[model samples]
Target: MADVNCHKVLMKALDYDERGDKEQAIHYYTMAVELILSIEDKEKREKMNKFARQALDRAEELKGIKKNESPKESGKKSIQTQSASSPTTNAPNKTVPTVPTHSPKLEVTSKEGYTMEEKKVLEKTSTINAKVYVPFMEIDAKERFNFPIPFSDKDGILELSPKQKKEFVQWMRISELCQQPEIIIGTNPDYHAIKQTVVSDCSFVSSLTVAALHEKKFNRRILTSIIYPRNSKDEPVYNQSGKYLIKLYVNGIARKIVIDDYLPVGRHNQLLCSYSNNKNEFWVSVLEKAYMKLMNGYDFPGSNSNIDAYALTGWIPERISIKKNDPDFNGNQVFDRLKEGFHQGRCLITVATGELSDAECDRTGLVSTHAFAVINMAEVDGVKLLMLKNPWSHLRWKGNYSEQDSRWTPELQRILNYDPKMAQSIDNGIFWIDYYSLLNFFDVFYLNWDPELFKYTYCTHKMWQSGIGPVKDAYTIGDNPQFSLAVPQGRGSVYVLLTRHITSIEDFRENKEYITLLVYQHKNGKRIYYPHDPAPYIDGIRINSPHYLCKIRLDPNAARKYTLVVSQYEKTTTIFYTLRAYCREPFELKSLDTYLTTNLQVTGEWNSSNSTAGGCQNHKTYRNNPLYKVTLANDGNLAVELRAPKVFQVGLELTVKELDDSSLTAPFISKTTDNFRSGFCVLDLENLSAGKYLIRPSTFLPNQEAPFFLKLKSSAKLQIEKEQ
Candidate 1:
């Protein structure tokens, strides 16, 4: 009989098949076949042949079927039977509402410059509770399912908690908010509609500004995508669902934020932060409420607009720093890149100015250390002009293109698409700037690319266990998950995007997830261990944002398997992550969690303190370092390697001691050499005694945590200490 693990994998394959995912089903089926084939015992193999044969047969049949054809309709025999609770049964046909028969032409597009892939990813992550919230759907609005949020006892039989009672009693109906609270989220999400109130979250609002800027050119910002009962005017119809769901990409996966209508109200029911200027337009207000709920409260320490852009659009942000005085500075090239990016519908660009004094900000008509959205660009008769939008409604630029200036003539206004009437209004946040003035004022720009740039992408969602007792950090090396990516031959770009999920509103906390992505190539034509090399294009160490992105360029010579290590500096809470690889061609991502070996071999990727942080080497940090404990029931040999970034040399030191209770100590062993490739410490012992041993691998470089491998070969069993 197959074991539980094997059985579960096969069942997952069956489920994927039922969901119209032939490719994923095939992957799971192949995993099942490999699992059984790995059994060494002859008796076990014979008994498991039933399962192994079934997996192979199903895989073959599925492969033979055309992708466009359904396997169930092909009438082929299935190796694994469907489970009992497959959710397909004869019911009233009312509960499981059928999706209305709408053609693809009915699909709505957004002005966020979303490519096809970005749009699809966004749609998948959004949750539509049409029966309750979107009553305009074919489902009946009065038919309430679950009451969405569990705040109070509906029966009135039990005592309500104080918090719940307050929320229940103070909950204002959507109908009572205004004389005519438009069901529509907004006429259109324009800059004027959003206003930052008490909370400090301009980065998020600036992201909305960018999303709102392109609606006239594209479709709608993701803001309106999840709103229910959108009327013919592109406004949402208000109903009694009393709840709303907004979609955001958490760590790479789409997570829905469920929120009730119990918004924080002051003397006059004023929204706390990020509200619309139009009194009755509640989308911005509702969105802020849902976000606060997701954040757990009113704690918005503020973050970069790029970070919020990723959550909103599912695009990976690229950071480009400006050094104006550098000899390599090319203003024309930068301008051309931005121009082409916007024209090709490939990027949403936003800029941040250097810190400004309060007086300077007010006098110069700019916000201090504020973010601005790039809406349009033009070069009319050799004069470069950039259209921008300040999230703040009144801070108009006082530069050459200022509203008070004479530069806004007939031809220039037409080129910049400026409406002189609207430009004079304080509520309209739009403005245009001279090309030279833009480069002088802005310090940094954030660019998020369209998903269509990558021909293929492979994404996997996982959870990393970090920050527990004692050290309160993640395992230094070894234990964290590693993925082996085989980048096939090509001259293309690849990006590894790591994203973390945002928690519920009341459960929100500052993200303490610091991650680094490292890649290493194979050596000497060996297949077992692919060591780390200081490769270029890796992201910086310890990025605290919800998302981290690193880029790698592949060429004809870069066709090989590279090991990708996802590591953390310190662990706070259990972090959920999604690892996404975007490339021009299809690639393979294989997990190396179970690829354990006892042979005295080499492992680990190469890294250096110069380019990246060297791990807990003595020279890097004098005290409080990482130590790995390995226990041997019998005699064994341990190899500690120190490899260089450029050269293939290795340096190492090995120390063996018994557990504190054992009261035993071995010789102080160390090795060094001036010869090339001489930095290696190998312990080759014969008739080695069997006992618990603590092996501390060190290097000459102080406080440097260089990558190394520990391979042990012994007759007796060996066990590394349990990793948290």
Candidate 2:
């Protein structure tokens, strides 16, 4: 009965408040508070207190208004009061309509308990529709940006002139636009032109730069170096380092290569190299040995050999192997050498997108089954290795010989001795891999992307095609997952997006389910469960990680307003690592001041106190690793503001502190987005203390006057309210 009476009193207060009867509203409000206080439950009492505070705050705002003042005048005062005192800066200078800010009245109770204390209710106007205008450019500017790389001398930082930096950027763009050297040197006559042109136009500029730099730094011209591990006594293990080697191959033929004693060999028997002759030929030669080894001395044109061209027949090494029991294994640090090898070469590979259509190529480029490939080789450790890439960020070559492809055969099955399964997938044209070869080879190389900035690009290609069709002039390696060489412009460069977080689990079956809000029911909903499409609960994933998103093709009736409830299933958790390259967006030159004031707003406390300690932390395994977790809440509105002197480059650090840990650390920035609600930023937390943390939200573009607002209540608060 008491609970019912309290509810009735609350309803009465709401009614009087709606009807513009301030005195009556206060009267009912007091009654409701009294009724609520009578309840013995502590939680219930706290709820009543919150309600009472809201009522009182509203009354106070109306205190100064004349009883019969025109609604317009009253409305203006309300707007002014809300903006001037609100936590976020209320800029009155913009031209767009901004949702007015309102200060929340938090009712705090003693942790132990508190007795009810009554106070007089202030008065306020009821029906004033107040509005404010904000500028559009303010909200549209980039919220988070990276600082330009800086060069420093022994004395101090060397600042590049604006014109110099601009020129540097232009050079980079032009270089990227220039075509990369060709990957394939086909036997056909027409392809001869491409190969000749590649060899002709290819100046040793990059090679020359590297050579010159090394010469200037060192006293001699060097080709390659030997890297080895030292013993506990700090003695060089020369023989052990030789235990791992990177054999070289060109045009399907093994070539004698030299190694330097000064080369840095990583624990995992990794080898680093800056240049190679034929990447494709290298790959094919490596594959053939693993598939059909005729001993290191076997001549290519043998008495029993029937084929004219060299092609890999058996096993190829794809991954590094390091065992403590092994005579020279260096443990975890062993893998570091391979990573460095890629860096040395500036190994950026572009891949053809998707499978060429009948109008384009033969079979969908599904891996070993139909596609044949050749690669330039660089020997690492003692093992022979073939480095291949999934052109589509994360897709694997499905053919039998691919690295970690479906286990279809065994390595021992194809020793130098005869085995039926040997050369099994070779006919299908897929490159096969063997683990033994990796240990014997040195390190493989490829390019990498930074995980911090926003990236976007569009490209089309005229490519080559094969298999039962009109003598197709060229096939487009459409959306293929394998990596490609950046063919120079006339020869054509492959358009590709270099990214980290963007490569998500295209196969939903691999990932666990989370809370998902179903906005609309589809007629053929069962299609989502079909084998080809395995993505589960798309809405939440879409909402949480927009920065990593690709194309989202929704039904025509995709809801404009709806709720997506998401909760992690069980104790399963996810961590993300990122690789990225910059994606240029359509530019609109607008003033930074106007952009911040109208388009974006600040969140949390931002007084420039340099309290990096209080900022958000990300989930990181080590101080250098950063991981991010994004959740969709009722209040998720955000706008970014890029504020700096015009024509500036600065390296900005964005971090995420995992809320559930004690150490505030993150792995790496994962994603960047233009839309606040649709996309999320990748988090970086390398310099945080150990603990779970939240994204401070306040740290982005500190001191900038951009603005943003939440469209709904915070989920945590809503849950608490519901429980109460």
Candidate 3:
């Protein structure tokens, strides 16, 4: 009977596999494999194990293909071939049927090429169709004068400059702006042709420049992939209907931005916003317009290129300060890293200059507070060099490797594949700078790395409510949002990114909130009680930027589990955020949900008269600490937490007691906090027998008067009440 059931299950799985139902096929195949392995007769099991193994291998191959493909290319077909045979039971002295050596190929077509995992990503994304906002036919019929027009009640026109708003002649479509308007003028995006005009978004323009250069160098579409209205080849094309949808990674998820084709024109028939040098290429304008719309206009305040690049490509953003203030800033190490990362197509690099005086700028031929794209890096004959592009499309660096510099020897030119003379003829803002010169001239390096470099990625969206925890998390992190990362025994890189959602324009300009991430080595996935007790594996610096990244490396000898705490300097408002983790090795990431099935919270204060101000064990008044009675109905785990004001040091102590025992002097099993922490402490008891218990929450010092909150969590149903 068991053998017959296994054969029936295997046949059902094959039926699903032939019909391209991978989900059901995998399920039934796994079931059949498990059943066949349970047979007691070794000879009979071996006869059927081959078929079960084949089915299991095919299922695993399908899963592996889904894991290896990029999210965009996940829609491609996954094909496999399998023999059409079922396991058979042989009677004594009877011959078994021969399995076929070859069978027809089976093609499994995923819906829209998206697996269950990719569909989850799409479910979180917000799609906005332009036609729903402003019908394209309405604009063509003149029913609407302008698309995304400036109005007092809307986000439109807020980013426009005073000059742009005053000199704005009209909203002109792409066809009217140029004689032969094309979304992308050339076969590939040209980084040199991109020019910044009138707008103060040098960082954004520089971001686009390097992104375009990456595509040209590697033949990958980093910028164009976001824009919609594409041809069958997936290349972005101009939309005649005046409606387009562009996907941008913003706040936390991939959000589709819908915009019209109308471009802002000045009185002199010149485009008011950023434009491309090629008169007909409108991709630069279109992408910029969509991004500007997200920023709430053309009046874009300055931002680093890494942030812009993250929004454009969903890559990991990392900022490295080059200022002399940082004692650890090593120019040589940074250069080597950039060279390796850029050449390997794992990163996009951009450098920004600090505020420079006019004389300083003139001497170096560099712009003040401007962003420049690092398009290429080379090491020729031990001479380190970098190719940079100025978004202004003009000023070339007057440093050692400048066009007019004497460092350009024929030998150097040949090694670098150069034509300095031709480069000098056309002032296209491209120049070579020595690594040392770059270290001296640039103030910061913004690197956006390819997340695909890691085999696993995970993200979680959350909200941090104001007033839930202490405003300043300098001493304790028990109340902060925390996560657990379980890495298997291996050596690999792990990165955790905390992205604060941008709810308003003030998020960029005001710079009110400061946030960072802290990682620590933890055992048994326990919560971190104190900030510096365990010594953080990676202590991040707090910054107002939307993204904060914390990186750590795992070794086989190190602990397998870690705790990640999202810390804020002083939280003033309720903030929405997304935490994403990328790892080179397989890892498990999840929020540390501390709440149990049955929970209770109570508020109390340590004061002189109430007898609740009893201090630590050393003090005679410890017996007078605030006590609670806990009654458990079954064997389970119990967790007790004590939270006080920053002024007081607190801890929790739990003691198992008899059913009728009311005395505080004696207890069965006692567990106390390892140490008193400022404002927070925790005590966990696992596998306690069903019975009554007593919990004591106390301060560290005698006569410390402050309010505190005690919380109790248990797996089994329990009742907790303050002891009278």
**Winning model by TM-score:** 3
Task: Please give the ranking of all candidate structures by TM-score, highest first, separated by commas.
Answer: 3, 1, 2
Sort every candidate by lDDT, greatest first. Answer: 3, 1, 2
- Per-residue accuracy of model 1 over 1-724 as CA lDDT, tens digit each: 4444665566556545534466877898888888778777788766666566655655655677433344586565444321112112221122110000110111111123334544444344332221111112324222332455543322122122233333333445455677677634434566556777656566677777666655535663444654544445534565455655555544354455545555444555655456777777677766666554444344555567777776666666876666677777777788888888887766778888888788867766877778878888878888887877777655677877877678778977776667666767654667788878877777877877766667677766565664211111111233456777777788767788876544432222355557667665542111222212223234345666666677777777757676676666555566666677777766777665433335433323222333232322324442233344566665544433332211122333334545333554444433322222212323434334555554444333333223344455444566665212
What's each prediction's clash count? 38, 127, 4
Q: What is the lDDT of candidate 3?
A: 0.73
lDDT of 3 by residue, 224-338 (tens): 8777777777677876666666767776665656677777898889998888888888888988988888776777777888789888888899999896546787777888999
**Candidate 3 to truth, TM:** 0.75
Local lDDT at 149 for model 2: 34
Q: Which 10 residues in a row give candidate 3 its minimum summed lDDT? A: 95-104
Clashes in predicted model 2:
127
- Model 1 misplaced regions, further than 4 Å: 1-172, 183-188, 228-236, 265-272, 326-332, 381-383, 406-410, 419-422, 425-427, 463-481, 500-513, 521-542, 556-560, 567-576, 597-724
Among the numbered candidates, top lDDT falls to 3
- What's the true lDDT of residue 195 in model 2? 13
RMSD (CA, Å), each prediction: 22.8, 30.3, 24.6
